[model samples]
Target chain A: MNATLTLTKLDVLRVRRNTRYLILAIAMPAVLYIAVGNSTKQTSGVEFKAYYMLAMATYGAFAGALMNNAARISTERKTGWTRQLQLTPLPGGGYVFSKIVASLVTTIPSVVVVFVLGGTVFHVHMDAWKWVVIALVLWLTSMVFVSLAVAIGYRFDPDATQPAVMLVFFPMAILGGLWFPLEGTLEKIGKWFPTYQAHKLGTDIISTGRISMESVGIIAGWAVVFAALAVVSYRSAQEQ
Target chain B: MSPDTRTPNGAVVEFENVSKTFASPKGPVHAVNGLSMSMQAGQTIAFLGPNGAGKSTSLNMLLGLSRPDSGRVALFGGSASDAIKRGMVGAMLQSGGLMSEVTVREQVQLWAKLHPRPIPVAEALKRANIADLADRRVDKLSGGQQQRVQFAMAIIGDSPLIVLDEPTTGMDVENRQAFWATMRERALEGKTVLFATHYLDEADQFAERVIVINKGRLLADGTAAQIKASAGAKRLSFRLPGVADADLYRLPNLVHVERQADVVRLQTSDSDATLYALLDAGYRPADIEIQALGLEQAFLAITAEDNNHGAGAGAGTGIGNLEAAR
Candidate 1:
């Protein structure tokens, strides 16, 4: 337990110290939210600012799990940092847990940026309970994609993993209603994706102001499957 | 059983009939073939071999990075797994194995966290002689400096055993000497060190025992003097006066003799005995020099002789052609 905490702290420090990426992670999603949200003049029943704000929040959470996690892991493995960690007394579980914690930490700032911008610019209305629920759903959704990113990163070398992560991430973002709401043909396809389940559960809880057991079940199922796969793939990679 | 047998202090590391085979596209390549040897604690043992001699494979097994196909590898009278958990072993592999973005101090502290009780970060940096470079990023540092940081990470826990695989590969002559001094200091402090290097002179300077491997087999294992005595051939060179260079082969105990221009070089095992026999045979020539064989010569003699015998055995079969191809 001590080893795990130490490793997790180091992982957080690494992510925190990388200033350029941290800036980009926060700026990209919030900038997208503001630019797109203001360009639309119509209140359009659902406030444009609130809708894009929620979408970008989900985007930030997804990026933390997918792009940021994958890149960091693949680069570390390629540079032999993973092997150095393996040589230590730290258990394999500790290393993976540290990565998850680091991803979660990175996701938090982006979440705050989205919420603050939403409240100030869009004047979006949500009670304290609703905000808390949205935050919880966002945190839980981050875990599923983070596990998938880790699995891909461990299974492939940096050169291959980066492109592979981008390939998977962009499709999920588009299909899961980041760019626009999943409608018509895309909505049918999006329902099958883990990201879709994550966004669906998140949007349902935030907009409906109620937690649905069905959405929770779907998100929970995806998290379990991805986390299990990540663990197995990581163990196999360590043996290699 | 005697206390020595049950808890041996001499052999800090022992490999009993250890073997490792890796799968290749062609077939299974035997990296290590049933090798057994032991080294006393506080001794600096050099593992010398040519490329593909399974030096890295054997080191990996000892470090618990890979398991042997058969037999056992024990460290401090315990298995590799047990030794690893005890934090009794430190390693500097061929790869520097450091995070590129992290500063020197951060990397040291991260690894230091692995031990239950570890040396302070300042002390480990000071020991590696890289205290000044503590704030420098790993990728920003020179290869030698990065190597120093890696060395620091390895030794931060004060592990009793240090395994260095070609640790001085990217280092300059001065840095190499400095690194050797550090390693010598560690050994002097009663820490066992297993260093694998293709550089025989470096091994000769520091290793108390030299283990030479060739084609996945242990060719020789002993002290420098003992290995030289067993496998090293003495060389007697002289400028022949009017005698044909080819005629030097007639000298007794001369396994092979070579003539270049007016000088004849005779390689034999017994330099003193051969010198006397040569003088008694009325072969007294100007500038006769009987030189003691160095570690390089000893390594070549053992591995070359082994290959020769192996080739000789496989001559009748088509495998001899494959061996020659290799």
Candidate 2:
């Protein structure tokens, strides 16, 4: 087997066994979907239930990916496991790539639970292709936050990562309009954020059959920037 | 020996005039001076040093975790990084790096998969003497068992060169013995082994060659017997009721004298001459006793020198003084 594949498998195995991560990624989103998503009525010429469901699902996927990756990386950094891996044939790039893949794998449960709840209970109506597009867009855009999570892992000690994740994640979740509907100046600010773009892309696909090229471009741009930062941080992390 | 004195072949590890300095809160600290040494394939070498004696710094260079400020560190005729990429070296660092949540088996298996041709997981566990604890979580294990797990991780690869730093730190007497037995088994398979240890007796019992360092400078490079041969003084004591301490101190090459009741003890550079002088002084040879110092005392006496190697000239002079003092 390829080295990266082996690493990915090991990472997946470890991530699956982490109960705290599973709860954080899946249960929190499920509870949020049930609590806030139940009372929403139609708004903005779209069913409010569907809009809030898509927004929360996108938030769950993005937050799950970032927090899981950051927690793993920061723990490894604290334990000096990163330095131990450096003594092996495993390349730095391979280790980071494995973390990204693990983050993506772990976040799937969050997205699935949200979608299942939304479709079964709320009766979110959409074509098969629309559903696939929304899921795919959300999953793909979550990669942007994966890199940002990696940067956080490299920049801070393990103890600081939990607060750092909360500090960065909640504001983005709020400003990105995952909770309440964006309006006025808040919506204007949220327009430039990747989380807002991702949620809009998912909800837009459900409302309208067409996809936005501008949103795709913006998400890709953020992914590239985060990827660059991750690389820089990983290289200089130990020096600091 | 000088760097130029190294053998041309079969030298699996080499350090040529390597020096490293680190910037500390107190100023620049020289962790390793211009030190040179090499180990042949199948050689088990022990690096002996006191605290802050550059042992860990040198091992870090060999493991490619840190680069030397000057000169080169090579393994298998290539740079340390190249050798590491080729999966030729396995190491057990002093810091405990195992994941607390993972079982011993899972951790060892993960590390085994990282190498190109790792040994069997079962075999690694058995050799490291942790097979019974394989199913146990790392955090639940005692400190000695965790050290054994770390050892298992290091040897799982079956690499040609094995480097360990203070590998037996938390081990009990039984575990320590088992650890060295496993190390001996690996060496018998023609693997090159280098370990840094504070236990001079462990070095004497296990290592074929010992390298002593102090104040970031190379103090002595020889076998245990050879290092012991370099000790400054040996004690020659006798139950002489009438021999005065001043008379024993007057013996040639005598460094110090002690008197306790009816016995007189003389510390001398040349025990034979001192004994003959004492015999000539009318003390019968039957009452005299000479005691050879162990490696521990010899190590302490050698490294306690005030030889500070400041410039490039200092290291050579310090080592030279070491040899002369011997």
| Number of the predicted model whose lDDT against the real structure is largest | 2
CAPRI tier of model 1: medium
**Model 2 local distance difference test score:** 0.81
* Tens-digit per-residue lDDT, B155-201, candidate 1: 88788788888887777888788788888888888888899986778
Kindly list the per-residue Cα lDDT of model 2 for residues B47-79, writing each as its tens digit: 987767788899888887888999888888777
Q: Provide i-RMS per model in Å.
A: 1.7, 1.8
lDDT of each residue in A167-230, candidate 1, tens digit only: 8888988887777776689988877776666666656655666666766777788778888989
Task: List the candidate 1 regions with Cα displacement exceeding 4 Å.
Answer: A39-45, B1-10, B241-259, B272-285, B312-326
Task: Give the lDDT of residue B149 in candidate 1.
Answer: 85
lDDT of 2 at B41: 84
Query: What is the Cα-based lDDT of residue B175 in candidate 1?
Result: 73
**TM-score of model 2 relative to the true fold?**
0.88
- Model 1, residue A23: C-alpha shift (Å): 5.0
Clashes of each: 0, 0
TM-scores for candidates 1 onward, in order: 0.90, 0.88
